[model samples]
Target chain A: MEFDLIERIRRHTEVNRDDVVEGIGDDAAIVAVPSGRELAIAVDTLVEGVHFPAGTAPADIGWKALAVNLSDLAAMGATPAWALLALTTPDGDEAFFDGLARGFAELATPYRLALVGGDTTRGPLTVTVAVHGFTAPGEALLRSGARVGDVVMVTGTLGDAAAGLRCLAEPDASAYAALVERLNRPTPRVSAGQALRGIATACIDVSDGLVADLGHICAASGVGADIDAEMLPRSSALLTHFADADALDFALAGGDDYELCFTVPADRAGEVGATLARLGCGAARVGRIVEDAGVRVFDARGNLYEPARAGWNHFAA
Target chain B: MEFDLIERIRRHTEVNRDDVVEGIGDDAAIVAVPSGRELAIAVDTLVEGVHFPAGTAPADIGWKALAVNLSDLAAMGATPAWALLALTTPDGDEAFFDGLARGFAELATPYRLALVGGDTTRGPLTVTVAVHGFTAPGEALLRSGARVGDVVMVTGTLGDAAAGLRCLAEPDASAYAALVERLNRPTPRVSAGQALRGIATACIDVSDGLVADLGHICAASGVGADIDAEMLPRSSALLTHFADADALDFALAGGDDYELCFTVPADRAGEVGATLARLGCGAARVGRIVEDAGVRVFDARGNLYEPARAGWNHFAA
Candidate 1:
């Protein structure tokens, strides 16, 4: 039964690349990294209830599982290549496996990412994806390079996914299709990150809300950030579905937005913005790096803004 | 709380290598692969009840989780390099994390394997490890290379871990310290695999029963295998603990022995045997590859023998 499921997954995700000496069916997968490239690897695990709400569609879960890891690679300015999935299901449901394989393939086909290897076990539903990518030597982005005078920018809009989760809880809430799609299938800023390789001083994907993830950049680079909350980019969907105060809170602390939060020198801000625009993901400069030690936000009236929670914590509950 | 656990894990496993451009704490780990090397990657998942008995020591669970992945790399004749761990637990228990970290470090330190990057989530207990190793380009031992006239060999003694598991179930079963240790912390045959790179025609780590795993090699290589059941290697502990018939059953069909089952040319068998012996893991030849399709075992009376179950299956229950 396990072998048949593996065969089904293999058929769904058949990637043909000369560099892949061996894919699935072996004890380990072997891939050749080109001479001047370094391998960028990242792993993320999603529990049934912790990462997603209970009774979510299996296809959406599969898409989000691979999406989160791909977002990590995008933060590192790496090109997607291969993925290994460790999937745990309470029961071996054939339809669930079929849906999962289709969803995984839908997201992976565009990037040509091969499903190299993984393991399956019986337990509570959990999905762990480890993605491997490649970047030119010394060209990958890191969060520790932000400078005091750098400008903070974010791609696309924030708060949509968080608002979508809230809408999920209130069945009578006005359904915002775009926001829900954003929550289910996030667009990893792969090309945007690649375009910012030599331009951005620091980069991180906003998985743990804007304030908390930017705090990581601040701590790593030994700088602080001052954000103009009024300048935060919000999609039409988010604005239509939420009020001003609630939308601001969702954007600031609700998390689950996979947009790239990056920094560039003040002088290169225009160039970076144009580059991202050319890559089809326009950027909005919402903040600037400061010499202080922590994140600070200001409203249009210049009053300091404080959020109730910083970000998502896996073990806080 | 998550950060504190991460810090504790970081303190337990610290690796210093010039090639590791970035370690933990980043979205992705960046590692340099030398000009002539290829990366071998593998992943394995262990659930609470499926992989181990309930109430098992946390340290043992940690060790076995990593050991299984390293064994996969060993089968590919790759030197262990880095590992990513995705640990899911019902709750964050400090003592459990401490013991788990210690056990993981105990096995990783000798291989200089760096704990590069991973994720932690709240869920049922599960440990998924993705291991990365390097091998010279085209030097990997693959399962599809065994020829028709090759001799099948296995490293170390078999059936010890299976017998050890049985002993654990029976409270009155005489405590076999060595066998129990084998069941909990089976050693990965790294050195032996490295030694057989050019000598062995094919290689696979014996996670499933010997017959089932060997059947994988045969299926891949378009060959069959015939084994002399009486020549199967058995540890003194296994022989002392069970009757001859039961011990043979365990040796042939019991899983969890992280030993290398490989094939060599009939003429070069002696040289490979001596090489493994020098590496401190003596090899025993008990079978031969043939032109047919499936694995066949012959008892001392020269009659074919079959077992009720071929190997462990996650969904069988």
Candidate 2:
């Protein structure tokens, strides 16, 4: 039965790519990657309840699983090529498989990403996606290159997804369908990342909120950041639904937003914004890399503010 | 925190590979693949209580996880290079993390396979390993290359692992320590697989019993096979532990063995056996590919024989 589901997935996710020599149905997939280019590989796992909430649709679960991994590739300034999925389900239901496969393909098709192989096993619902992408040797972005005085920027709007999560907890959630969709199906900044390949000094996808993710770049680059909270780009919908304080909290430290929080030279920020704007993701200059030791946000009066939480920590009790 | 465990895992599993531009501790891993080789990728997932019995040591669980994926690379006649791990655990214990990392590194050190990237999530214990290896262009051993007149052979002994599982359930299983070791850790036939790359027409690793794995080859190659039951190889320990009929049944249909089952032209069977013997794994020619559509066996008296079960089915209740 698992094999049958995999067969159906193979048919739906198959892409006619010249580099793929052998796809699903083999012991291993064979691919001919172009030489001289560096491969960017990442793996991300989403548990049914931990990574996503209960009552989440199978299609959303599947899309988020792949999207998060793709986001990692995007942060590396790599163009995705192929992916392998390891899916463990409590019950191997056809309906669940169909919905998940459809969602996976829905995101994968736009990128021409081929589902080269996958394995389905019996267990609690969990989806692990491993993606392979490519970048020109010297152009691949890294989180360790942001020097002091560099600027930290983010793509697209923020806080919508986390606000969407909050909306789901209330009885009037249907009014926030757009926010719910953002929480469910995040748009990985693939094209924007590719455009920022040589321009961005450091890059990271914001899965664990702005402050926490920027902290990663800060830690990795041996620098710190100071951002103005008023400059955060929040969706009008997010602001309209939540109170100002909650909306600011969600925007500053709300995890689950799949936006790209990256660093570029302060002088190049303008052109970088133009490039991302051309890609349709729209970039925002939210902070400046500093010589300090941590990421700190300044309120309207330049006073330091603390969030309810730093970010999502997997093992935190 | 998961990062602390991942830090320890990173320290233990880190390998010095020039191909690895970045290994773990970044948004994504950057690897430089050498030109003139095709990449072979495979993933396998092992869930606690499903893939292995409860109370199995964490070290054994970790070793078996990577070993299973390495077996797939061996079947593809590819040289293992790098791997990514996605581990989900219910309780992130320090002891469990240490043991698992130790075991993973113990097996990985031999092949020089580097742990390039990984994600640790909070959930029921499950390990998903994605391995990448390489083979020369057009030299890959595939399951679809078997010819009607090809000779079918297998490496090492079969059914030991399955018998080992049975031994674990019995109180007097102490007498069968060797069998139990086989169940816990089956050696991947990597060297033997590489040796057969140019000579073997088709290849697959025996995971879900000899018959089931062989059936995979036949289905892919569009051919059938016939084997003599008496020609099947058996270990002295296995023979001593069980009745001849029970031993044969286990050899034919018992699963969990990580041996390599490959096909070669009848004319090259002798050289193939000699080459495998040089690798110390040895080989036995037990069958021949045929024009029929399904695999069948003949006993010593020329009577047809049927197994109690064809093989393990993941979703079969």
Q: Which candidate leads in DockQ?
A: 2
Q: What does candidate 1's lDDT look like per residue over A136-233, in tens digits?
A: 98899999999988999999898888888778777664477788788878888998988889889999999988999999999999999999999999
Q: Which ten residues in a row have the lowest lDDT in candidate 2 chain B?
A: B308-317
Q: Which residue pairs of candidate 2 clash?
A: none
Per-residue lDDT over A54-91 for candidate 2, one digit per residue giving the tens place of the 0 to 100 score: 77898898899999999999999899999999999888
TM-score of each: 0.97, 0.98
The C-alpha stretches of model 1 lying farther than 4 A from their native spots are: A172-174, A314-317, B1-3, B172-174, B314-317
Interface Cα root-mean-square deviation for all models: 0.7, 0.6
Q: Is the docking of candidate 2 incorrect, acceptable, medium or high quality?
A: high
Q: Which stretches of candidate 2 lie over 4 Å from their true place?
A: A314-317, B314-317
| Residues B1-317, model 2: lDDT tens digits | 54567778878787899999888888899888788988999999999887788888888988999999999999999999999989999888889988998889989999999999898988999999999998999998999999999999999998888778888879898899888888778899999989998899999998888888898899999999998888888888799999888788778887778999999999999999999999999999989999897889889987988976678552241
